[model samples]
Target: MALTNSQYETIMREYEDRQTASRHLLEERTAEVYARVEGYRGLCESVASLSVSQGRKFLDGDEKALEDLHASLSSLSAQKKYLLRQAGYPDDYLTPVYNCPKCRDTGYVDGSKCHCFKQAIIDLLYEQSGIREQLESENWSTLSYDYYQGDDLQRFQNAVKECKNFIKTFDSDYHNLFFYGTVGTGKSFLSGCIARELIESGHSVIYFSAAGLFETLSRNMFDYKNKDDIVSFHEDLYGCDLLIIDDLGTEYTSNVAVSVFFSLLNQRHLNKKSTIISTNLSLEDLRNRYSDRVFSRITNQYTICKFTGTDIRMLKKRLQNRK
Candidate 1:
């Protein structure tokens, strides 16, 4: 999803704060070292002067002067290192400390976003999703087989194993998953488990309920005023490592929604990105709701897992009431 202008400002402010803090820290440490080490302050001045002299000599095409200045600078550098060592400091202790060395805390490298920047965006998106609390309670660590019984239990166990296996060996070549079941049968929970695992492993994930997902797409596609938001919205939708559409068939499916949905599935499929769709709809329902081409792509490219059992939410409520 697209970040508002304020959100973008917040991220940029954070990056600026990091750089400012690093600079302040380096200045403080350098002052402390200079106070403790005699002659170090004078040594710094000499080094700065020599650097300026070297630059002028090169500009003047005086090779001999440049060579002498370089030698002097090298000797000064060695002396500085020796002094720092004697003062019980690392040789590079005065250098700026960056949270992300790749970007030097700027959030970009060579005009492209660094991994840390992408991570910041993912964090913001998760916060915006409003499902953080649900995910916290329903992730992999809390998943249990005690909620199932009989053949339902066996299928649940098998589904859990397959989900874990999917996370363990996940790669670009991995296929998507279709979790179809009645309400409260752990389909969305399993999707959350996989999302949590992959996100913790440094993958980008965007999870949306079917209605919310379609609404965002519809707004971006049709709203002229928020046209700028469309670019970032599309980028995250299509470019994230994994996309999870929970309760897929619950949206108000207009012609625009259906067309966009088809494009989303087709684009992600062609890009080899994985998607997990949890729907409380049967295969026949899916065929009726979506086009034949959409059904064909899903059946051909996705691992279909059919979930069956009593509603776990009701079971939990009954147990709680008994208590």
Candidate 2:
């Protein structure tokens, strides 16, 4: 499921929009700082003139004049420093600053990666998938089993209890889980709640529908016109704390997509990394859609969670329409 060129362009445009937003924010902050620092403009002009005059005196080979200018420049620098301290400003108060003061929003500092840039990239990638808003709106507190009507209450409660226990003990070494159920069941919600908990705990978690992920990875692998590297997709998937692939078997099944998917899952399993896959497809459907090797790996390294419920979305829709 490769992304169309248009989709890639749209994603890049969204990235550009975020970059523009950061620039505007920085510009506003700079303006605010300029207004806060009294006589800042005059101080800058005076310093510039003194620097120019010092250079001119040096060029004229006048030792006394050069020494005097050096003393003057030092005195000015000290005065600026004292004024900044008096005003409760940092030494870099006059510098063009960014929202991320850590790296000054440069994305990196001193040959090391910056935290803000990493978070920004993660935010942009998540936004590009168009699921950020939907995911953010879901929480465990809102996930109710009451909507799972006409079901065996005892069995449903047991399942919920087990899932809750698993989430509480979730760890990088814990077995990955494959959630199977019909459409509109609570499979995706449970996974989302787990993701939310993990993310809130300071772990990096990437949640993407199977189709969206396949399209993103495939495009990065095939599309060469973009500045983003396919290795980035691989690194994030493999290197992140957790990866959740939802709605598996919904993507256009292809040899390439299957291969990439298999490799990704296999590598993560070998590294003992965790992944949560929720799908409407059963084990038979999974076996038919993917290679036996992939199925075997999943069964061996992952836990299988069965979701039993009616279509919660239909109930919610009906309830909403009544209002």
Residue-level lDDT of model 2, residues 32-69, one tens digit each, is: 65677676557657878987887888788877777787
Model 2, residue pairs in steric clash: none
- TM-score (C-alpha, index-matched) for candidate 1: 0.69
- Number of the top TM-score candidate: 1
TM-score: model 2 vs. ground truth: 0.63
Instruction: Compute each candidate's TM-score over C-alphas.
Output: 0.69, 0.63
Candidate 2 regions exceeding 4 Å error are 1-130, 149-159, 224-228
Q: What is the lDDT of residue 45 in candidate 1?
A: 99
Native-vs-model 1 lDDT?
Answer: 0.84
